[model samples]
Target: MQASTLAALKELALQCARSAGELSLKRMKEPFTVEYKTSASDLVTAVDKEVEKHVISMILKRFPDHGILGEESTFAQDPAQFETLWVIDPIDGTTNYVHQQINFSVSIAVYHKGEGLVGVVYDPSRDELFYAVKGEGAYLNDRPLHLDRIVSLEEALLCTSVFWNKRAEQMGIDLIVKKLAGKVRGMRLLGSAALEMAYVAAGRLDGYVSLSLNAWDFGAGRILVEEAGGRVTTMTGTPLPYNEKSSVMACNPTFYEELQQYLHVAENTQTD
Candidate 1:
């Protein structure tokens, strides 16, 4: 993609994100209906649907030829059918939005021919916008983010998620958590993989590892992290295609190698 095209997409994505975020904030405190998806713990809210509808409508109107893939709605215009695709997660941290009324975000990214060209993640609660174009450096609220260059796994701070079937998957993650718990400065579970990746790009967290996130969950944040001088791959350190659902490990270059070694072990031990 040309720099100009990327710039335009970035601007449009940012505007859409802010608009969706504002809508989220306005309705966050209201009595909203919540529903369950695959499982009870896996949640969806009226706001999630409404926000996604607003974003998709805007994108479709602006770029009629572009395809959209969103969490609330089924994928339209399969990736193989289009050169340009917009992946959106209108409410990334829906559980947080429902309970704590915080920490959620609006994530958007444009991919051309399967390569990410633009990315944006907006946290309305904090009013922080994290964005990047393919070659351009990433930014947190307009300030360039400098990825950590030192390889100090022991000193790093890691973030991860606990799945709905917490007990079933605990062993693998527990091993890694125990091994790194004493070594790393700290560990956190912020409940949103996209926000975690954005945090990694912003240098607020050293790395983020999670199992089984869909394309919409990490699509945008993946580009942002890579643009900020970080790396993202499966837990086993394999390259990821936007179409595949897999365990994700994203971190600055400094800690990627060491983190990969541990994550690879966890990945191998998982039976399901």
Candidate 2:
């Protein structure tokens, strides 16, 4: 994509993210209906759907032909149909949004044929906006975000999500978590993958891992981390597909190699 076009998309994503975030923040203060999707632990609120609709309308108003792949209301399950696609997670941490009313975020990203062009993640609680235009670098609010390298895992502060299911067991998340928690400087479970990945981009966290996530969950975050000079891939060390569910691991170059080795060890041991 041309630089100008990419910039335009970035601006649109930023606007949509901020607007959706503001709406969600405002609604969070009020009572809203909540429902479960897969289980009681998995939640969705009216605000999530409302914010997604608001964002979709805003994007379509500007670019009617563009496709929208949203968490609440997905237009297309397969993203290959659209030349330009907007991937949105209106409220990334729904449990946080519903219960704690914090740690949640609005995530938005634009892609052209599987290549990320614009990424925006907005945290309404902190009033922080982390954004990136491909080749333009990343920023948190107004400040540039460039991650500094960490030499070793023992010195690294990392975060991860552990969902309870067969997938988690199959991924050997139990072993991975136990190993990393003992090895890293500290471990955290932030509830929001996008926010955690943003923290990794800002160098606030050295790395992040998750056994399962959809495209919308990490769409904006993957771009932010990469633009900030970090690397993101599946836990198995494969490139993430444009709009599919997969595992995620994000960190700097040094951590990628170091962490991947540990990940392989856990997976190999699980198989053995």
Candidate 3:
């Protein structure tokens, strides 16, 4: 895509993210209805749907030809076949939003084929807006962001999550964490994939080990990490899959392969 077009899209994404985030944040301070999607721990709120609708309307109005692949609703645009496709997670950490009233975020990414063209992850709690466009550097609000220098597993601070709805998946991820916890500087479970990835991009975390995330969950943060000089890929070290749930290890290239080796083993051992 042309630089101008990409910039426009970035601006559009930023606006939509900020709008959605503001909507959620405003409603967050008030009482709202919650419902379970897969499990009691796996949740969604009325605000999640409301904010998604707002975001969808904004995108459709501005770029109707564009296709949408959102968490709350599915649209008919094939990203692989179209010039532009938006993958959105209006509430990337609904549990956090519902429980703590913080740590959640609004995430959006526009892609062509499988390549990210524009990405935005907004944390309304902190008023932090992280965004990047293809060929452009990553940003944390107004400042440029970059990952930390390479560190060994022992010195690295790694992040991971346990799936609330999938016990076997949690067992696998928990086992990996149990094995690695003593080796890393520390481990963190922030409850928000987008925030965790933003932390990786900003050098707050050395790496992230994710299992069973949908395209909407990590799409925006993937490009942000890459543009900040980190790498995001599947457990086997290939590029992220566009239209599926997959495991990911996102960090700088230095220890990616080594990290993936362990994740690959964990994936195999963790079964339903």
Judged by TM-score, which candidate is best? 2
Clashing pairs in 1: none
Q: What is the lDDT of candidate 1?
A: 0.83
Clashing pairs in 3: none
What is the Cα-based lDDT of residue 271 in candidate 3? 31
lDDT of 3 by residue, 1-272 (tens): 77777878998999999999989989987889999998788898899998988998999998888888888874545555556789999999999998888899999999986778888999999999999887787999969987658677778888887534365345566666567777778888899998899888888888997666888888888999999989898765667876667777788667776777766766555431
Q: Give the TM-score of candidate 1.
A: 0.93
User: Residue-wise lDDT of candidate 1 within 38-113, one digit each (tens)?
Assistant: 8877899999999988998888788888888888874555656778989899999899999887788899989998
Name the runs in model 2 displaced over 4 angstroms.
74-79, 163-166, 266-272
TM-score of 2: 0.94
Local distance difference test values of all predictions, in order: 0.83, 0.87, 0.82
Positional deviation of residue 156's Cα in model 3 after best superposition, in angstroms: 0.7
Off by over 4 Å in 1: 74-80, 149-151, 162-173, 267-272
Better of 1 and 3 by TM-score: 1
Give RMSD (Å) of candidate 2 vs. truth.
Answer: 2.3
The sequence of per-residue lDDT tens digits that candidate 2 reaches over residues 1-272 is: 77777778988999999999999988988989999999898999999999999998999899988998998874644556788999999999999998888999999999888899889999999999999888888999979999866558888888888635466677667666787789989998889999999999998888988877889999999999999999998877888887888878898767688888888755543321
